[model samples]
Target: MSAAHNASYLSRIKPGWKFGSLLVLSIGLYLISSWQVLLVAFILSVALLASARVDLKQLRAPLISIVIILGVVFILLGIQTNWLNAVSSVLRLLTMCLLAYSVSLSTRFSEMLELFQQVASPIRVVGGNPDQVALALSMTIRFIPELKKVYNEVREAQHARGLANNPLAVTVPLVIRSLKIADETAEALDARGFDSAPANH
Candidate 1:
């Protein structure tokens, strides 16, 4: 993930506060049924990303993917329900997605890890290791961009080979490469004793 501009005001905010606000806003989006309000929210979300000085170049692929998915959703909802519901759903989701990307772009990975660790601390009461939980969650977030890169690379290679029309051509390599990456990450974490509990003093 690209780091936010150091001088950006949003970069100075605490990760916990940003994450909390994102959670609240996401929940609130579901309660909103008016497309007009959602459109305003979408505008504000874009403005938030701009205020954070997020790199739009880095977001190109993800934004394209989101647009495609949203398009499909719009068509399906419009047919299954009503055009109004489809418009509201699309606006709500797009706004939430932009808001989420804003937070991720503005926040540092280390700060996010710290926040996740704190939030997962309660998992210890149920025989779960908070450190592992935090690491898993943090790594998952980190993997998103990596996976996107992998997908693009695989897709391009398939396209060059004239297999662009074959879904399996893309799916097989992407899954294989993703698994390879996951395996390597697991090995690295194990080498660092990431899964081991600290000994009593």
Candidate 2:
């Protein structure tokens, strides 16, 4: 998490409320077809991120990826349908991604884990381990940026070796490193007796 995110008012809001609102807003975005409304929603999402006071620099990589992906999406949709449809699709998706990222940035991992556990509690009735489920989800969310960092490091190293464009060279090391991290995490959880503990409601 960014220091700026910790200092923002959005950080003080409950994770459940922020996530709930994000879900509602995302659903609303999907239902609205007008490009004008979608554009406004995208603007509002940007404004929401601005209000959170998160450092834009931290978002550079993800923002770049989003732009590239959305550009491809726009082109494909325009080819299949109309340009207006492509515009609306891009705006709606971009808005949702921004809002989701904003929520993730502002909310702490502990808060997200607690919220996920609470939401997953009903799984216990079906003989499921809600704590494990919640932990898995939380860890997945928490490690996304870490994985991205690892990927960049691997890419940079490969680039330095003049193998930047070699898919196998990049992918082999990334997968190995990611699995190593996952194994370490599982061992740490086991040492903490996470599986032996009762679920916290």
Candidate 3:
């Protein structure tokens, strides 16, 4: 399980405020060209995450992946431009990713749903349904974890059979199971009369 699923003081903050803060920081960091400033921001972000009690172990894989990717990008940028610019760009990206992860770790799914609905509300005036949009967003978020679990389970079964190197060995069953889940979900929704509901006036 992820540290994001746990409750914390950061989770208790208003979603709108948190979103705004992250947006401002991301844009500000992106526009700045100073490697020193970006480095400081990354360090401070790590310190802030520590104070907020996010598990460093839970984040290790993602953090390392980001570093590896950035290292490649930095090498390319350095060859094309200069070392200073490459370093600063990588720092900015690292800072933005860290802050974004921090926000996700602290936020509840319900809070995320409400935030999406609020952001989507303007679409209502343009004949789009904010409620439906928010529902879709929430469902996607909820199902992603389930889908990951299913994929892992399938992968393990294939590995046990010594078919791990076979692409079809993993994907065929995954696709079939995913389709079955979708069908079941549609049926459940229909049984609940969601499809039969009358349009709002």
Candidate 4:
């Protein structure tokens, strides 16, 4: 609420500062964290989360997903015969989840497209189709949340009918709906000019 706090939050929201810090943190933590150096990642994640200026409301989905994943991971890890390995597995999963959250919080869709374009340049020179590749990536990014919502709706409907406990209750409907969406999207794209052009390469 104070002016100093407000200013610091605004400063952290700047694009360049966020990207530079993420780059350094990702590389540094990735290198050292592989050797079980948790402090490096812990420090970086703490700093990144601290600097975040956005509303926590925007983080609801990721936070919920992380909680669900961590819950399942811990349950599975508990069933593992090796206690040390189980603990390590859970810790590593949580750490990776945190780092991914940091990246998502700081990065924008445009930045993601730019990064993917640059990374795909070499493959594009080869036999790859960057346009289609980018399209798929963007579609996946956009559709995943939509799919998740659809899944939740379907699951809730199933639960109301006493089928939620059934494994098929959740998966079969999700897959069927997703397939329908994919097929319709492909048909629409083809109806346009997506795949009409002759091969350039």
Candidate 5:
């Protein structure tokens, strides 16, 4: 329950799932609607996200957008008494968010690239470079953690400057930092010869 202990616990997720256990657990929880199970999943997801163990930056934008959009829709589009659906939908989304976190935390980028290469082999045989695909995969895997770190640093700096509550202070810097990361990543890939295509002749 202590902050430090919680942080350490979050960082200690097992490197991979065994026997698709997370999936089975999720399914059982969904069917049972057990509050303890859902609560644990929510806590675990938050811990993983905050710890940057699962790398949720890639999901932040979409998740936020979905929440905002759905919040408005629920207020205006729904029958206003459809509370059950709203609760169910929100819980389902929270579970999905945790599921996504689990995937990134448990599955290594190398394993993902290997899977991609297997699927893209025919295309690679024609002209594509699996290496480039792998580079993209690496970036995708790294993108979340890197951006989340940047967001925290930027937010802290803003707070230090006494602009912590200013929306622009957070959003602008976050976007700028994300763009800068994307640019640098692209440059690194190019410098590493990842931009080169396979032989055309």
Candidate 6:
């Protein structure tokens, strides 16, 4: 998100509280089967987003992705069951995604790392390394936007070459770019001695 977005009300809220609320609400979304409830949740999310004052232009990519994903889900569910089931499922999933996107956009990268470490603390007893866990989680969260950029770049290139409708043209390059990112990430971790265990001396 742009620096201007940081001034938004939702962005100014404490990251922990925002994340916790999103987590709980996401879980609740899955438990409720009523389309009315899902529709209400979806509307609330949209209102919260507007209150955040985020630029609608910034949302274009994610909104497109959401439509594509939910369109597939709606089609599959319609084929498997009924239109009512499809609509409810798609709305519930979309609501959860919007809530997640809002939180991610609002929260800073450092706040996300701290939140992950806080969450991982309880798991330390079971051999978890909070620092590493936090780094991994933060990186994964940060990579989402980067991935979107890479995908758009690839799509534009393919479009220029008159392959805009070819799924393989997009998927192949996206996968390759993602793998390259993973490899670079591993190399950076290695350079930081991530693989070294604490000395017992």
Cand. 5 TM to true fold = 0.40
Q: Looking at model 3, report the run of 10 residues with the lowest lDDT sum.
A: 1-10
Candidate with best lDDT: 2
lDDT of 2 at 30: 83
The predicted structure with the larger lDDT, 1 or 2, is 2
Candidate 4, residue 65: lDDT: 84
Instruction: Give me candidate 1's TM-score against the actual structure.
Output: 0.67
Lowest lDDT block of 10, candidate 4: 1-10
Structure candidate 4, residue pairs in collision: none
Q: Higher-TM-score candidate among 3 and 4?
A: 3
Q: Give the best candidate by TM-score.
A: 3
Model 5, 127-199: lDDT tens digits are 7777777667766767888878888898899999999889999999899878888888778877887646666
The Cα local distance difference test for each model comes to 0.86, 0.87, 0.82, 0.65, 0.63, 0.82
Candidate 2 segments whose C-alpha is farther than 4 A from its true place: 1-5, 131-201
lDDT of 3 by residue, 19-82 (tens): 8999999888878887888889989988778767776676888988999999999999999999
Clashing pairs for predicted structure model 6, backbone only? none
Q: Flag regions of model 1 displaced more than 4 Å.
A: 2-6, 131-195
Q: Deviation in angstroms for 61 in model 6?
A: 2.3
Q: Estimate each model's TM-score.
A: 0.67, 0.67, 0.72, 0.51, 0.40, 0.63
Error of 4 at 48 (Å): 9.0
What is candidate 4's TM-score against the reference? 0.51
Summarize candidate 1's per-residue lDDT along 1-201 as a digit string, tens digits: 546454588888898999999999999999999999998999999888987888778788899999999999999999999999999999999999998888888777778878878887887788777666756776888999999999999989989999977999999999999999999988998898775573557
The Cα error of candidate 1 at residue 71, in Å, is 0.6
Number of the candidate with higher lDDT, 2 or 3: 2
lDDT of 6 by residue, 35-62 (tens): 9888998899988877776666767898
